[model samples]
Target: MVSVHRAGALLNEASCFLCRRRTHHHLRFPTPGFALPREASPSRRSSLAAPFGRICTRAQAMGTESYTFGPYKIHPGEVFYSTDLSYAMVNLRPLLPGHVLVCPKREVKRFVDLTVDETSDLWVTARNVGAQLERYHRASSLTFAIQDGPQAGQTVPHVHIHILPRKPGDFEKNDKIYDAIDEKEQELKETLDLDKDRKDRSSEEMACEADEYRVLFS
Candidate 1:
């Protein structure tokens, strides 16, 4: 629970986010210096196009934006896009080429807990990111899904929308992907304690992919 004084200070910093993107001002502050990404020059972003394999070591991204998904701390490099309220991060174990997750910054476990503003920003972020992914992946369609809660197979407890860019006939059956998602989550649950190390694709892999996607927004 945030006090009035803290909330007021947040509103002051929110002007930075609102100037570039009309994002909500009341986003929960999980960490210091976590905010909407500042604009990067094309030359700075161009390096993102290179394959991750080319780089020998994993380095934190030049961008300052960072976020979390449930108990998992999302690294800065893995975050591609963000509004004041929400951010998009690559899936560690994707069912498709361009599968990603758009999550609210608040770490709200259930959808019902979301403020109206958070709800609106979450979907808007999804819609915007889905379009970019579809174009980038050159897919014929997309899959937008939300598990919503534990009964609905929500892993990690945080509410998130999964966006998968689909090509024709590649993933013909709908149930298959959802099944895969469930199965994968089950495997992760057994192994990961949900404390920072929520990785399947190495951090470098997710970071490189995010860097590529960052180019779209920049």
Candidate 2:
């Protein structure tokens, strides 16, 4: 079994099954003097039209602001959209090309743990995010899943809704995505441990993707 220990405010260590050793994973931290990519100019935001324009307008009317997800803050330029109760973010390990997570601002562990307001906001946010992702990825279908608890395959303790954009024939079997989700973290860990070239996506890369999505939803 793999065990994880929170090492500090900005890092965590997880035991590896292969080497029986611990590997430290750096939490996403703001880099000093880090600037947005040159290509991430404000004009980019105007190019990709948001499919769910009314959703964005509604969120703005609610005076919704960004919040923190784990250690990372959900900034306006880094998220597709957000409401007062929940926000959607780019996934670190995307199950598909356009997979993202919709999470409540409150750090709840299960779906049932959400407050009535949060529950409503979560699905509404998911729907908007899903629509945007489908348009962005030109997906034929979408998968909105919630792994309610650990027994139900919730890897991270936080309550997050998975919005996966799917294409026809993306997999030989339709249910393969679930198996892929179950094994993705472990597979990435093993690859990272043994193959030095196979590193996790850099913070810059993630921010870049987020920027693109921000543009798409703008």
Candidate 3:
């Protein structure tokens, strides 16, 4: 997010800005099985107590295993929601409350690079995730945005849709809060300066929030 001074410019100059990144996570339904990386939380570790075979899962395995945005590796334990084609995860530095990202599993850099199925699935997943977040965050509205390419301010070379839960009067100017893309990915400074001031949330903090969000999907 941002301040009122830059809000107006953001609409025109930014054009489109979504979240920063996406990866793997727990696929709540079909398996209820997600393998935490070797150094995962105790609770997430318990999820893999069953067997190594069950834990041999991927995001597409109806369970969150591990995946990547482009070259950046994401911790599997922190992703809370995903489908066969897409995933929704907590932002390391969210623009607003209940802000999250939904991305296709396949890391296609450009929006046009996605096939019809990936495009359809990405939007549908964003819609479903947004609806749940709206209810959970008890917000009045939501903003769904995507930065299609470098010119559009895409940073990670991956396609991601930002889902920001909005509330009245939350911002001096509502758009101010949505200043940049996902703050998390900006740490790597893949492309733009949308997020240059903030520090990142610790892995533990991310995993903790992700654990809480998983209930919304389950």
- TM-score top scorer: 1
TM-score between candidate 2 and the true structure: 0.61
Cα deviation in Å at residue 98, candidate 1? 0.5
Instruction: Rank all candidate structures by their lDDT, best first, as comma-separated numbers.
Output: 1, 3, 2
Ranking 1 against 2 by lDDT, winner: 1
Write the residue-wise lDDT of candidate 3 on 1-218 in tens digits: 79886776565333211111111223111121221222323443222221111111122222546777765666675677888889887776554556788888898898899999999999999999899878776778988988787676667888899897766554545544444443334543532243342234445445555655676677
Order of quality (TM-score): 1, 3, 2
RMSD per candidate (Å) reads: 14.5, 15.6, 18.4
Q: How many residue pairs clash in each candidate?
A: 0, 0, 4
User: TM-score: which is higher, 2 or 3?
Assistant: 3
lDDT of the candidates, in the order given:
0.65, 0.56, 0.59
Judge candidate 3 at residue 120 and give its lDDT.
97
The digit string of per-residue lDDT tens for model 2 on 152-188 reads: 7766667888788876655556776776666653443
* Each prediction's TM-score versus the true structure: 0.68, 0.61, 0.64
